[model samples]
Target: MEATIHKFEDVLIEKNEVQKMYVNGEWIPSSSNVTRDILNPANNQAIATVTEGGAEEVDLAVEAAKNAFYKNGWKQTYARTRAEFLLKVADKLEERKEEFAMLETLNNGKIYEDSLVDVEDAINQFQYYAGLATKPHGQTYEVPDEIQAMVVREPIGVAALVAPWNFPLVMATQKMSAALAAGCTVVVKPDKQTPLTLIRLFEIIDEVGFPKGVVNLVLGSGAVVGDALINHESVDKISFTGSTEVGKRVMKSAADSIKKIGLELGGKSPNIVFADADFEAAVDYALLAIFAGAGQICSAGSRLILDRRIYDEFVDELVSRAKEINIGPGWLEETEMGPLISKDHMNNVLDYIRIGKEEGAEVLCGGHQILDGDLKEGNYLEPTIFSNTTPEMRIVQEEIFGPVLVIQVFDTEEEAIDLANGTDFGLAAAVFTNDGAKAQRVIRKLQAGITWINTFHPTFNEAPWSGYKQSGIGGDLGTYGFEEYLYKKQINTALEVKPSGFYKG
Candidate 1:
């Protein structure tokens, strides 16, 4: 399909008003009668309005999903049938690829080509889960005393998924597809800053003939809609993707109801480079790990830990390469990096950069926001690089979800591992080294959930993706992810033979 670039006014579904919430497979206004404008990150213009849902909307969505789980046939449907519907959704997404891609780019301020890849990846996630719907593994066991036993996996009902704004459509699809594939009903509260693409996605879901109440969407701030969803009694599970602080709050809320929770939260991941490693390949991987998606991804390698032997040369090369990164509007074809989600977020990133400088780090390259002639209205920041950073600096400890990289040097592999594990987060880490034994040892010792050897950010649908500590709980994007929304049941039956326990009889 050809790419389509849409203006803010031309392709939006609703203008100057909150697009109605999708409940029970239909679009309707919130019971609260309140709405908020959804702004385009590129120009900070109001592109559309989204429902300002509150506790009341949360109740309605939960009730609808509960009804769908019990009263409706969505869960009871055959696994193959569910797979067929998911496959159909994937097909429809492919059919409307250009539209969804344009909406994602406009809503999230990612480059057009990158947004297209995200749409394609989202579709692939649906397709992958569709294939797995009928393939859940069950175990049959033989009992000792004339009893037969078997274990089956059952869907955990009414999942409440709260997605982050960084990769709106992709993250929503990741949780939604996996839950739906497992025959669970879902109520999603997309991040308010980037709700349009997800709302548009529900439009397609409605058109694809999903049963009423199987999937629903509500929009509002995290404090409003997000909190309500987490605390709802009927919600059986909570899957969230955002910051560690918010993840802790959600975990506490879920604790009240004892609801199952899956969290993919913040990261201060490290990308370690050894002197004997493939220099060109390591540089390329490091660049993509931080610059791609403006470094908003939780798995982004924000810390560059280099062997002290080659620290000076690596910093020079990295800085020189980052200087050439093209920053412009997402819609432009030549743009490599685009604006942050909003001016507020841009300012937050800038504040961190200032903190890095104030804390005694050297600015190796770009540090200021870019407000050039044509790009004045957008929230663009130059690809930033800092050197002479210590593991104790705030920049190395906090998740600066922007295109910023902090460089630090370590003398030995043991010291590098210690430095990498110093942070509270343990989401992802990478080691670039030619020494096979050292790489294996480092991988085993790293506290992160996902580690790369001589590479970075090579995620697959089959691998479990989550974090170890404050980064979050549970896994997403694999068979393990599917199991997160499912519960296990054991069944036992007496055989024809009578037990001889009571031999006196």
Candidate 2:
């Protein structure tokens, strides 16, 4: 499809040059002098040039964060002070919401409406952490033998937060906000494919008057800067959101340092629909789960498990609805879904569709690229659905992370739960049913971390989010997420005199 070319001035600051890295509160070109082209996936065009970082830059960023954490009084700052900084960042983000939204769409290839929501959520995350910073709680305990005991939660020192390209601004905020709230300086390594929004975020951080080196942004491929950040000795913790394979590598790299690690990884989430569900509502959620962000989310409900009785009807309706979705550049108001992140990602999705066909899954609709005018130049793939998919098929078990949904029929509730739980991932799952008892049963039996009943992708800042099993370790959002950046220390004091060694009782 020929992709629509929206004018850059409408979405981004026309004069803003793409930056390579934000180290010590300043933007500088990489020491290596190598640069990477930042492409607008919406139109397969070069939007800007970003410096490519290597090990030397990573070391500088880490050292800067460590110095800020220890010598710059960032960790010793009062909670309210940190909260104020976060609120200021939020204010700055709100002021630049429009510019950020446009940059998000231009870089990530998500619809303008969805990117706006992401920008809003990013701001909300900052505000949420701002409140959390001032409200950190400590525990006091009474002890015998005239001793007083207490437990305090302190910042874990410098943190390395590696964010994914799917939701660049929101994901970065998810880690950085929580860590900063906990009084930890941070080094953020945004995905190379969509580094523009995060580069812009660094500008906001500078404007907010955060202490120098409190927050750093480094741009490079995962193999370079990402690994360096994960393996840095001075980094006390690592928080990451990405694929499971890469998450494993990060975990391994962090093992040597024994750093605290929080991972929010991949998912092959299942959306179960029972015969008694509100069919229209269920279909709406199912489509939203797969098509939102072009199914690039880690929590995308790729597996749609339906009761055999309604299987045929659900498949027909889903395919029909998906066919009606408008595909174009993200800046357009009418576009529902945009292109994938890159040509490689687009090809990957198409390859998975081919594999589904070879594996004997029936293509209900849309197994090709959208090649119409304006979309032709972009990496646009049609929303696809596959029926008669078995649990063992790659299309059913693997996380395609694309606008593709696989349909599986189940004979009973037990079978539905079984099919849903039969994957290596346990990120998120959803069920559509009117029966409260059955919903409760499925919720209990399902192995996923976050379960959605009659809803999908409606996460709030107040809830703790993470995966079970191979989906990942540690949590994000809520109090649980804040605690990930902290370490606990217990204090015991003798309140009364103790007997000397020579004294007899």
Candidate 3:
């Protein structure tokens, strides 16, 4: 069978409803009756409208989640049953893969192909956590004494998850699936900018028959709904993915109630190209690292650290390839890169490009907006590259969250390591080299949670995903991620019921 291509008009036509929040297995509008228009970003069109949920609605969602955990037996559900639910959800998601992918592309403004990959990753995430749900959750230890003690993992009760807009469906699944697999109930607040896909996901969840309130969706601005969700006394844990500033705020809010928190925050990841590296492969990976998602990726390697020996040639080739990239609407089959998430985002990126130029860095190539026919209204910016950037430049230090790359040259491996580790973030980094021993040595000292040698941004579900510094507090996406929604308890049984000899005289 041939692959099916989705048109933006068709996606919009299919998405006819004025979307609403999903709470306690019901489709409802916000208590305030306020709504926000959901933009396509590709063409600056309002494709849908969603409830602008606030504290009132979040309280309701949290109350429902608490009830599900304490009153509805969700927290006590068997691991196999939870796993079965997860698998069923995964199947349902796969059945609607195209629809979700189209929604993701329309809402997030990423290339359709990237949106499809996001759906695939989300499916894999659910399936992976499904398997983990039924696996061994505790350890048995041999003791010297007669008493037997077991360390068992139990659900951490209600989890409040906040997802970012970059990979809407995938990030939601990353947090929700793990929390569910661990037998915890959840209330998810997808980024208000791109809540369409997640809202649809909850429709599937409701159809698949999760106990009422086991999973809920509250759509709204973060400042409004997010405050109530994280600071709720009944919320046992908080899992968030977004900027460092917002992550810090979530941490503070969660601290008020002393809830367990896991954050996957912003990054200014480094992509280093060594002198002896495979030049063409390094360029390709560099492109993948920075421009794959139009640089909206939290782990985008926006900082390119190049060996001075091959710096000029590598940068020239990289700039050439970047210029050749076809930038347009996501639905275009031939487009390689898509627009920014919104006009504000595009302007922000253009401001960074200006700042990079003002700081004495050369605009290597493609730093202007594409304001031509049919692209005038959309949020499109060229994949930008800057050279001669210094460590102190704001564009080099800050997370632009755009399709912008800053280049800096290094003379030695020690210098490269220092440059890579210089940033406050340690979320991700990549080292390109052919020498195996050098690759290992450099990666070991790279001071990042996730590192790639001869690669860029490929991650697996079987491994943990996290950051070393302020990039995040904890991780998500593996055994470590699965355990974040669980807490350990020790059960002790006495071998003898009789009391010990002589207490008082």
Highest TM-score, which number?
3
Candidate 2 stretches greater than 4 Å from native: 1-8, 13-18, 500-505
- Candidate 2 TM-score, true structure as reference: 0.96
Give a tens-digit lDDT track for model 2, residues 377-485: 8899999999888889999889899999998889898899999999999999999999999999898898888989999999987898999999999989999999999
**Structural similarity to truth (TM-score) of each candidate:** 0.96, 0.96, 0.97
In angstroms, the error of model 3 at 154 is 0.6
Tens digits of per-residue lDDT for model 3 on 388-455? 78999999999999999999899999999999999889999999999999999999998899999999
Off by over 4 Å in 3: 1-7, 13-16, 500-505
Worst 10 residues of 3 by lDDT: 1-10
For residues 43-128, write the lDDT of model 1, one tens digit per residue.
Answer: 88887777688888888889999999999877798889888888988998998787787788888989888888888989999999
Candidate numbers, best TM-score first, in rank order: 3, 2, 1
Better of 2 and 3 by TM-score: 3
Q: Candidate 1 has which clashing residue pairs, if any?
A: 18-49
Range of the 10 consecutive residues with the lowest summed lDDT in candidate 2? 1-10
